[model samples]
Target: MQDTPSFYYQGVAALARSIQVSDKNSKFVLYMNRADYLDDFKFKKTGVNIEILQSEYYISDVEEPESFPGSLYTLDVIKKIAQAESLDEYIILDPDCLVIGEIDSRFLERHGCNIGFYKLIEGADYQFNKFPFERYGKDINLIGGEVIMINTQGAKEICQAIGSITDRRGLLTEEHYLTVIANQGKIRYCHINTEVKRIWTRMSYRNCADRDYLYKIIHLPAEKKKGIPRLFDKIDFINSHDDLIESIRYFTWLKESVLLDSISKIYRWTKNFRGRA
Candidate 1:
């Protein structure tokens, strides 16, 4: 399962294509803000079992300084989908991720815990230690949210905990809450030495395959680069194996041009107007 905003349609296509080539038996579900933004014509012939679910926008009355509105609600959406569909377990992936190789389901099965997630590599501090370390002690490991395997029951507990939070001072974002849970030994943390790896920071594309074990899934977080050309190059490199990346590159280039952006916006507006009429 993956959650994607409409602006990252190309990433969705790349993810779908990667699954089609690598893990054909696995089900691929996409959760998006707007369902209509998906162009069915592009994926109808691909034989990929893709399901698109429209997630409800979460509106919070409380003024949050650190977290964005509807940001923390993603977990709620995942929990609702799992319960409504009677799913035993589901892997939640960010839209910008690609499955380059086969993901072994047996590796993700949990015995005692309800949740599984990737822990940051040992001895590699990425400066995510803003939480109160005194509460969790110094031996706690920080987990990444880019890819999470959740059990419906445990997720419900996490959601309840999130709802009970009145003070948002120490906890900055959803990742922090998840880390806290992992620190308490509430969740199972997957190691980086396995087939799953995360690229937290921006790095050269050539270094992606330099790891000891071949990574099955690659999580690319959204990072803002200085120049348009450099950013496009990085996007192209990370998604080098997928042809769908070209579309993303083209759309990005279009967004960089003022005239193209204006024209594209007008076209979308007119199309929406015609549909209403």
Candidate 2:
């Protein structure tokens, strides 16, 4: 490890702002490919160590030719942070994720073995979900890409293993990279059980929950609250916080950015056209 111990998140200035609050001590680095955008983030006043990753690092070798710029950029940053920190272990958290409570370090202590992750799509659903999940000529264990904890060794192995598959024509995703390495016996993945209330955080889009409104402004209809359990009210209470709102925005941008971006593009593309149907 050559650099200071740090946490890494790539993308907008908004994400860095959210991360600054949740992970106050760890260094934060933002990897922006666009220089103009890079200048915009200069005054975000992100308290942690903030540096923009160079774009050249995102290029894939011949083997992984189809690398998506975004995924490759993230991978490049992860490798850079892991190597720079020489950290025994480090976390890669989605900026949109709000830390309601402290993480379970003990959960990560079970390191050499698989660490916690959400389940991937089942084989039966592969035909429908494969376009999103299957990558790099291998089946991906559908896990949340937002938060990952890795020891120095695990990080090193993941970095090296991913580098070998230069042809990303199939596996152009960060989560699938983990899946590919794990299936190859190069690494083990711990499956995080969603039933356990606090072992992990949930992705709203995956669960079909509405994901707008600033975290500080969840306006539950008073009528709807009547039949709801006290627990439900509690859930709403926590969700209505400024800090949490910022964090969720940060995490959601990177995790759902592609989906959101695609939707925006489609909407824009169709705006000028008339539909006969």
Query: What is the model-wide C-alpha lDDT for candidate 2?
Result: 0.44
TM-score of each: 0.61, 0.53
Off by over 4 Å in 2: 1-14, 23-25, 33-36, 46-48, 55-68, 105-107, 110-118, 121-140, 166-168, 192-277
* Residue lDDT tens for model 2, 1-277: 1121122222223334434444354455544554443332343454435465665344444545555445545566667755764534455654333333334544556544424444544532233233334333444445445566666656666778777866554555576666666666665656544311111112222211333331211212111212112222223232323555443434333233456556655654575354532
C-alpha lDDT of residue 4 in model 2: 13
lDDT of 1 by residue, 53-132 (tens): 44443534366554445555566555565465444566677656666676766554634555666776543233543555
CA lDDT of every candidate:
0.53, 0.44
Residue 260, candidate 1: alpha-carbon lDDT: 49
TM-score of 2: 0.53
In candidate 2, how many Å is residue 30 off?
Answer: 1.8
Q: Residue 270 in model 1: shift from native, Å?
A: 50
